[model samples]
Target: MELEALHQVQGVQGSSYPIYLGEGLLDDALPNMIVERGYTNIAIATNETLEPLYGKPLVKRLREYDSYMIVLPDDEKYSGLNTVHIIFNQLLLRNADRSTVIVALGGRVIIELVSFVGATYMYGVDVINCPTTPLAMVDTSIGGKGAIDLPQGRNLIGTFKDPIAVFADLQSLETLPVSEMRNGLAGIVKTALVGDPDLIDMLTPDDQSRLAYRPERLRTIIERAMAVKVPIVEADHTGLGERLHLNLGYTFAFALEKATGYKLPHGEALAVGLVAAVRLSHRMGLCDAALVQRTEQVLQSLNPSNAPVSYAIPQGRAIDVWEAMRHDPKWRQGKARFVLLQGPGQPIIHDDVPQELVLEVIESLADGVYPRPRSWRMVL
Candidate 1:
């Protein structure tokens, strides 16, 4: 098993790992990744959603090696300490040792769960992320931020542990729901807003129209998003510096998730978050209103009918979402932080964001205070 191509990611922690993003790379890549990383024993962690789809093939490819799999229920709601405990128990039952590498073979939940297990097992173990979803590929899978949700908030319990390798198979995305696929695009938008404004331009109607049904366009979008995120990851894999910029769209995305009770996918939450950030940026005079309008236009074009309902969450559900954002771990001192746009490819992290403005935005969205443009018709 040998890879035809590889892109090496230099981590801020002074270590580097290869990210293989090509067809059939898994056949050669998986075995070699484990071997080169000095991990002899392996534990494949996946969910019911993806285990039958790709887990079996992955296991078959690695059949020569000593490996076992821990399959959990499929859903973001189960991404918590309880699931982590199940993974831990499985590893313990398998007698997985320090030499064992945990391979995550699903979306963000699986990746986070596997990383958490690896981070905690006998102190730490190696993690390899094979993200099936676009969100995991471009955002959650690579950064080494392993976490599980707590009763208090999202990602409340976890650690910072980089994976030994990350394999993003475009083929895996074919089975992903359209909504989930759109959810992944939110990270692309975030990466663009934070850095690589050119990529933002690439997400035009023409480009999206061409790629709407084409797999290549999706791959291109995912690749571009990954490229935009790499330098940030390299600069602050621990997310202590420039990497914080990545959180600009993320903060609002998290809030949207909390606001919606996690009903919205991460990407959908991100789309709403990006809009809120842009609106806030416009309100603060940080950027022109045109930019916000243009952003909304693009998002509307993406999937207008479903323009992320949390943005306009009904009055009945408004408080629930607001409370979620208020208690979100991503916020500091009970104040929500935001990633506001200065322009394309230039997102700024603002910690002193006003809650009143956020509330206003939520209310306006719910009440259709902002009129839906003609583009909404085009998008639908």
Candidate 2:
């Protein structure tokens, strides 16, 4: 029921907006935000999977306004230049002018695509994010950073654009699959491991289903995770400093996703990447060995079945993955800058990581060695 506003920059009109987090708030809150923002026309950007769940209800509620829906492909692999073109064509078909507001409904993939469309359509338009998944509700929805995956790497193309408002309805998450919920926890774990140690406790549950069974506890976890991101975004909107810490496990995660041809969902791959990152940090003497063990244990607690896939990457093919990291968006100058942890809540950026060590970790990850969790037995 409480509305929080991000800090506004001078001369920036749409940089600051309200974020609402609660259950069953969609019918009243989203419409009121649109009317107050003075948008007479609206376009809902979503995907096939989520259109029936969140998008249709929104359409019913917003019948007072001129509105149409652009349903995109639900797969994350489809988050590319082609998808953006489809959205643009829809905007044109619906005759959505600059005055129109874009309502982004669904998980992170849909949110990212909608944010990009709102950012590039006729220069810019208002975006209202209604995140149905935990990842979007906690991390992606709050930040204005919108990106699409390229053949080279994930989120290679992106823009910094804030939404006019963000509506996170916890009720919407009830319809989500359990696998998708586990995937979202990867981002929450990344947030906690880097900034808020209390969030680490939230994810320490041994049973993954408990998180879904306890909605109040789940809400607490989300709020705690967002507390870590909201301020960092407020301080460094363009990711010049502080915000770079959020790259925590993304370097290896993106590489893994690219290697698997993106069959792995973003969050699951991120969990694997977090394990590799901690091991790398320990090998680099940045973090103690205990930190590495604890981080892996926490991750395994969430998804005990996560393990390295031998078939996902060929033997000695980590070199290929290392090459993929070079093309990551986080690469600076000619080197890849990685967010390494010194300890819980202590993250440092390191770009001078030795090539041999990088290859060792990547190779081990491929061989199911370095990131081997306690439950590892090579299922595949």
Candidate 3:
């Protein structure tokens, strides 16, 4: 057995499972746990890029059983109902049964896809997670909010399917590209500002550099981020109330992603979104300008995988961005809701914020730079 420590997540109807965090869990601990529990059937669903990296090795370890690997397309654009059908076909063809465990073996898209399948296939089979990216480890994989994007809107189709267990192997993050690391770090920053305020300081350059190879610092960040989400998720299994706090910057972030035609990495869009959220918060007099100043400063300091992180939503597209927001699930009857920050660890959901005011704040961020708090970070 490896040194991975396990934390349990409570699900709806008293269902719960352990999330294991450490190195060597995939190749060593997973097979051992399966054998100890007398599991004879297993399936791993991952993307094409990750199959060679983590999937194949685990399949080899579990080769003696009815273990199979289903590799889908690699990017976010490929995730949809079509991808879900692809997994279903493979599971059906292989005769995976009620007790079969489906392992979601990649990042956000793969986690959502495989977990959804595991929930619906054969009226539910056991599923577990092996989240590879920092975004997945800290945010996506921890919560059982499963969904795939629809042409109508992002995360339009989905379920709340908790996995039987989760293994977030720090070793897997070694090869995470500079581009993806930005998304992961951005997720962490958002999580910090909303729930775990102490974590904001640890997201510095040195820690990010250490995160490149050192598992200890990586584990700390992952745990702290999860600490913020787990209890809220337990309290609000359905995201109708407190859980909404966790999405502090996402209302504007989703708009930015759509305005750019989904080309912006989620982390980049989130960084810009945090800036926008605080700006809106200031506009509403919810917080002082100092909070906004500090939000951008922390985000700018993050340089993951050794690349400077600076990207913005398209300028002169506030209308396009507004339409995107209207399409979000949070928008109701032409009145939008925003998760505003009164301060770090002090997030409030502000509803019916005037559409014109929302547009004003968003337009101000076009081309990426907001009015300077004199040392504000994001460049327009």
Model 3 scores what on Cα lDDT? Answer: 0.79
Clashing pairs in 3: 367-380, 368-380, 369-380
What's each prediction's TM-score? 0.89, 0.90, 0.91
- Ordered by TM-score, highest first, the candidates read 3, 2, 1
Query: Residue-wise lDDT of candidate 1 within 82-153, one digit each (tens)?
Result: 888888888889888887888889888888878887788899988889988778888888778888887656
Cα lDDT tens digits for candidate 3, 1-380: 25445678899898888888888788887778777777788888988889999889889988889889999988888778998888999999998899788889999889988877877999998888889998898878876878887765577777888888888888898877655676787888889888878788877654323433456767888888888888888889878899888888888887777777887767677888888898899999999998887777777666422322334446566778888887777666778888999888899988898878887887766553321122212110
Give the best candidate by lDDT.
Answer: 3
Error of 3 at 108 (Å): 0.8
- For candidate 1, what is the TM-score? 0.89
Q: What lDDT would each prediction earn against the true structure?
A: 0.73, 0.78, 0.79
lDDT of residue 208 for candidate 2: 39
Q: Give the TM-score of candidate 3.
A: 0.91
lDDT of 2 by residue, 8-62 (tens): 3221344467777888767787877777777777888888888887788888887
